[model samples]
Target: MNPSKTGLSFLWLSAVAFIADLATKYLVVTRFALYESIDILPFFNLTYVRNPGAAFSFLANHSGWQKIFFIVLAILISAMLVYFLFKNNAAQKLQNAAYALIIGGALANAADRAYHGFVVDFLDFYWQDWHYPVFNVADIAICVGAGLLALDAIKNGDKKKSEKKA
Candidate 1:
């Protein structure tokens, strides 16, 4: 099927997200020393660091095996997102965009995994002595995409309920 006729066209967004992720990571990796941090705002910082595991560095302290597992998982999820977009109508704009962002983020992280053996995280947020995990552009895209998807799901559920009652 022609990509322009389907949600596949949203891959442009994927390309943008992927490039942004890579560029930011490159800058952080090249410009900063490991664990180096620079404050951007009272509650935010640009701290360069490496993550060996998924979100919040889950299983980061594990042996070398988590790298392969995460890389494979990212590939599988990216494929699944593409499949979901390919199989559906372009009218599902919310889902399409969501899938595209996830695809871009997953692939970008996978690339980082294969190249750096870790995901580069730099956007840091904190309040007082407490700090949130450092993350990057891909993480932001993935999270925003996920939130959009959830919002869409909730909206459709409401629509379905209203239709059922009519």
Candidate 2:
């Protein structure tokens, strides 16, 4: 199959990811109480937490301006991602996937912020006395997408160098 054709498929992946993120957030909100924790394993738990700011609760302590800031920022970023996805060549499958994932995740979180003034988080991982920040499906998508983009950059760079030597 042509790699360039993969870009269109990535758009579908974005839709699926957005829907899944919304579905999971709905379940968590309806079934769990705020700050409630349910142990699923020795190292993981479902913990309900609201983040009004960016990752790691950045700017969460501010006087509520961050909510508006993040909502607008997410919208802008998502638009940019969509533009990039369309502009990207078909052979850049990984890059297209990266754009799709980031766009989907951004929209999901932005929806939450618009409706609830914060993002709903539930998945939690911890060990012994240390605990990682709670997150949700949207966060996962964004992180994975960003990683893929980085990998694509490195791979493309290598390809260019190889071509130059030939």
Candidate 3:
């Protein structure tokens, strides 16, 4: 419940996640060719792809304006996540993890936007001929963090109900 502890935990998680994301992106950029696919498993593969747009290549076609808009959005979201970390009880691990995950992913993608004007995606999943959209570490962090946050909410809600009945 201590503010310092929460802030420290958040910083630790964010730093680790950010570093990992950056390292992975660097590896992918240096080692893989654009649109090249490396099969990692029967149902998964690492396929290098650059997405100038948002998730699932949304607005991938519009080149000029959408880039700036998405960059601004990512920055705003990162700022909001930081604010949430400061305002909420960071002592709660799940809440802290959620904030850290968001910050890390936002930072990773923002870095990509600044450097390359696009985000590097590689991870892919498929069943036979059906393939899912390729994604990267940042997207993974966002999804995992969101799931954790959702679970935390349900847990806290149950706690509140139990207290009310007692």
**Which candidate's lDDT is highest?**
1
What TM-score goes with each of the models? Answer: 0.96, 0.93, 0.92
1-166 per-residue lDDT for model 3 (tens digits) = 5668544458677777788888999999999889988988999999999998888999989946887888888789888888778777656888778878978887888788778989999889999999999999988888888898999899998999999999
Clashing pairs in 2: 4-90, 4-91
lDDT of 1 by residue, 16-113 (tens): 99999999999999999999999889999999999999899998999979999999998999998898888878888888999999889989998999
Clash pairs, candidate 3, are: none
Clash count, one per candidate: 0, 2, 0
Q: Would you list the clashing residue pairs of candidate 1?
A: none
Tens-digit lDDT track of model 2 for 65-139: 998888889889988877777667777888998989988898899899999999999999999978899999999
Ranking of candidates on TM-score, top first: 1, 2, 3
Locate the minimum summed-lDDT window of 10 residues in model 1: 1-10
Pitting candidate 2 against candidate 3, the one with the higher TM-score is: 2
Number of residue pairs clashing in candidate 1, backbone atoms closer than 3 angstroms, sequence gap of 3 or more or interchain: 0
Ranking of candidates on lDDT, top first: 1, 2, 3
The TM-score, computed over Cα atoms with residue i paired to residue i, of candidate 3 is 0.92
Candidate 2 Cα outliers beyond 4 Å, as residue runs:
1-9
lDDT of each: 0.92, 0.89, 0.85
Single out the weakest 10-residue window by summed lDDT for candidate 3: 1-10
Please say which candidate is ahead in TM-score: 1 or 3.
1
